[model samples]
Target chain A: DAGITQSPRHKVTETGTPVTLRCHQTENHRYMYWYRQDPGHGLRLIHYSYGVKDTDKGEVSDGYSVSRSKTEDFLLTLESATSSQTSVYFCAIREAGAYEQYFGPGTRLTVT
Target chain B: AQTVTQSQPEMSVQEAETVTLSCTYDTSESDYYLFWYKQPPSRQMILVIRQEAYKQQNATENRFSVNFQKAAKSFSLKISDSQLGDAAMYFCAYRSYTNAGKSTFGDGTTLTVKP
Candidate 1:
């Protein structure tokens, strides 16, 4: 929970349209991550940010782009949505020098 | 690259009984961390327990305890006197000290507690 919120808790978008999910945190943690949960794949990291304007790709970052312009907000964008992109997205954060990462409620994204 | 493996896809235990969930990991780094996370129907990832590679002592949180074998690369979670609320999808995770924020997680084990 950790004072983390993801916008558009349930989203339905058409294929080929652009979609963006937002993660906002109030704890001012140093690390933020975006992950997608699938049936068989478990949870796969899509992107993460260490600081403002500093972002990096994760294992499944092929179709996802991320930006962290501010400390509290991190955005994940899909250039063109696809059926494969439909899944539950989770946002996680960790404080400086901490080992445990806390997660948000999650956003369910669907593309038809 | 590190990988976590949860061999048991699902487990069940009777109320007031005990159940152990198995977890094995492959890692080349000597200094890292291991964790157990539980996600119930709400899908909220909750931290169950954590084990550091350097610590030889096993960690215990009330009824939740961990059996950590550093040499065997095995970490198992044991829940004593199980309750219905303890039933959830448990995931084993690994985080290297070098890559602090990035965690590698296992497929997961769905636990069911019978009344």
Candidate 2:
């Protein structure tokens, strides 16, 4: 409910194909993050952006790349999709001084 | 680095009964934040409660409350008068006071409320 939306709520791609997921926020928050949720593993951060064109890697950033050219949109790309990359991806936004993050609906990706 | 752990993978409780979910974290920092998030079958994540390590008193929201033991490094969530709607996956998370908006989350505990 924080004015966040993830494009392509669902996606299917073959292995070795390129895939990109989009996260758009209307709240104009300064911080945006990409996370993947898996069974028994919980949610793990993939990448995050603090401001326009400013980004950082997370604990599970391998095989994944992100770009934040604008303040409203942050993109997560997988150079080459793999079966291991299939999972529910969530996007979250937070204000500069806020302690909590608001999440989007999430995107389900499948690699065949 | 901070890590969160939820010892219980599953739990059950009858309607109107009280249930407590366990959570523990490893952190050396003196100040930080802890949170409980609920994810229903709809897959929407909702914030249930939050506690600031600097506060001695526990944080409560309606029928939900937290028992935070700083010295023991334990944070547990107590749900009172549990309802069927409370049946869902609960996650405990820890955030550093100085870290940029990043949080470490526990695996999760599935709570089943029997009517």
Best by DockQ: 2
DockQ of each: 0.70, 0.78
Minimum summed lDDT over a 10-residue window in model 1 chain B is located at B94-103
Candidate 2 local lDDT, B57-111, one digit each (tens): 9999999999999999999999999999999999999987876868899999999
Q: Which residue segments of model 1 deviate by more than 4 Å? A: none
- Chain A of candidate 2 gets a TM-score of 0.98
Q: For residues A1-112, write the lDDT of model 2, one tens digit per residue.
A: 6899999999999999999999999999999999999977678999999999999999899999999999999999999999999999999999998889999999999999
Candidate No. with top TM-score: 2
Candidate 1 lDDT, A1-112, residue by residue in tens:
4899999899999999999999999999989999999985568899999999988888899999999999999999999999999999999998878988989999999999
The per-residue C-alpha lDDT of model 2 at residue B31 equals 89
Tell me how far the alpha carbon of residue A26 in candidate 2 is from the true structure, in angstroms, after superposition: 0.4
DockQ of 1: 0.70
Q: What residue pairs clash in candidate 2, if any at all? A: none
